[model samples]
Target chain A: MRPEIVMLALAVGACTWAFRALPFRFDLTGLTPEGWLSRLLAATGPAAIAALCAVSVLPLVKGAAPPAPLGAGLGAVIGLWVWRRSVVLATLGGALAYGAVFAL
Target chain B: MGEARAQFAQGMVAGLPVVLGYFPIAFSFGVAASRAGFSAAETTAFSLIVYSGAAQFLAVALVAAGTPLLVAGFTLVAMGVRHLAYGPALMKHAGQGRTRRAWIWAFGLTDEVFGVALGDLARGRRFSEAFMAGLGLAAYLAWVSGSWAGALAGGGALAAYPAVEAGLGFMLPALFLALLLSILSRRQMPVILIAAGVTLGVTLAVSATAGILAGMLAGALTGALRRATA
Candidate 1:
């Protein structure tokens, strides 16, 4: 088996176990509502998600120009999501926009 | 119908939206993994084992970039760390003193599942283990099946219509954009903006994995400081 596969399995397994075993309530009880840790935890979800989205969309490959189709598609997705509040609508709109741009 | 069966049925009904949303995203992951040179088996394994949309996508990118296994593994963990909050928020509903059942249900606590379960709770439904299990199982099947179908179809589709392949590549980014917009709020604006900026800057300077970690830390610190002063 490949070393990377093993590492992936172990990492995922550890995370799953941690989710089940960790004492979240006990830990939170130690902090006030306005405490730094509480605030940090509160922010982690949005921050991590935004970071993931940015990295995913940004041009990462060296010397590879940003793909216009992707940018347009992402814009469509954001616009549709804000306008409609529907993930399905946004995804479909983005896909259509991307296909349109790709065909051009 | 038995109470457990009824709850399970309700769970499945509630999970339909999540299942629909996961299909295209999972399919896109399969296509991206294939394009990144992963074997069909490997792609399937990622969905079955990791069972995380963002983490799986990041894993493929990290592997394509030839990152070290250890670094890649840790990065995936960091990406999933937000799930830790879900457990606490969900414990009152899903945990409910059944340690074994809670652990099993925890395995399926993806972002969408957490949202649905929480929504169910907010509507004054009693937290039923059977309900959560049914919801999780349905979503899991959709994800795994979608990945398999995509991996099998990706090669043939790409060979036939390369333009379609290019457009398909945009699916992940589009999906993420939609999710980010869905969760965006005045309270989260500062964190999201800071994180996006930090991620972009660090990615330009260093590596994508480093950029994500740095962004998370920076955003968290900024949030903490803001809260302390308010």
Candidate 2:
């Protein structure tokens, strides 16, 4: 409970909250899906996910660890298989695959 | 009011998987923070407040390395700059829903929550402020509590099970990948591929923060290009 640490947490929280909340300030009430703004916003969702996934997975395969890639590969395969049905199931399948392989 | 309550309850239930996914990672963060000399309370504060998964871990390391608070804060915020897009992007798809409480719920737009919300909306689920409230709160509570448990357990709690640790580490990425698959469309394929490529290339060359911004812009611009030509 050091004073500096508390201050640091508050600062980080404030800055991040501002970043996340910035876009809500705009009025998007009647924006059409066909407009450039709407199109970009639509693209933003998948693109952002793409960027996040790239960054997340980059750490795993970086040093070429055996279990890491193997497990992740299995997870992707099984997850994709389950994906045809549901996201939750795909996630579970992927995680289980990775867990089993990484554990072994 | 009752309908809002029901929607909120539904959101919480839907958030259960995200709750499960986040706990292990937050636990790992707590252990890392402890190992980095953060007291249980400081470690918990990072989760309860900042709530950025990668940034929180980076904060622990940076602060431990004696990096100045200002520099560390700048770096963490820079790393999360991509989040600036999440709110507007989600609202655009949310279809003029009730937003009287967006200011309150928007504070909880963590990456997983954003992904889950985005996916649900893409799949034709209607947006509700109440639902987002329940979703965000559930995930937030899980994160804060998990960090607390990990902090109290200290660093050695999971050392004996390194494999499980690795598995837990992969949870967020797996969830993101699944969500990505869920919303992917033929038209958007190019956007996603280019975004991933630019992100990887820039991340390898410059930094992860630069990569994400570049990727998002590239993907969005590409989408705009297609829209214009169509």
**iRMSD values, candidates in order:** 3.0, 4.9
- Give the poorly placed runs of model 2, Cα more than 4 Å off: A2-4, A28-64, A67-99, B93-97, B122-126, B168-230
lDDT of 2 by residue, B34-153 (tens): 878999989998898898776787677668868677766665665565576687778776645467677788888887788788878888888898899999998899889989998998
lDDT of 2 by residue, A1-104 (tens): 88878888888888788767766766543576578876775677677678767876787778644656456654664556454545445655565567677765
Worst 10 residues of 2 chain A by lDDT: A81-90
TM-score of every model versus the real structure:
0.84, 0.68
**Candidates, DockQ:** 0.50, 0.45
Give the top-scoring candidate (lDDT). Answer: 1
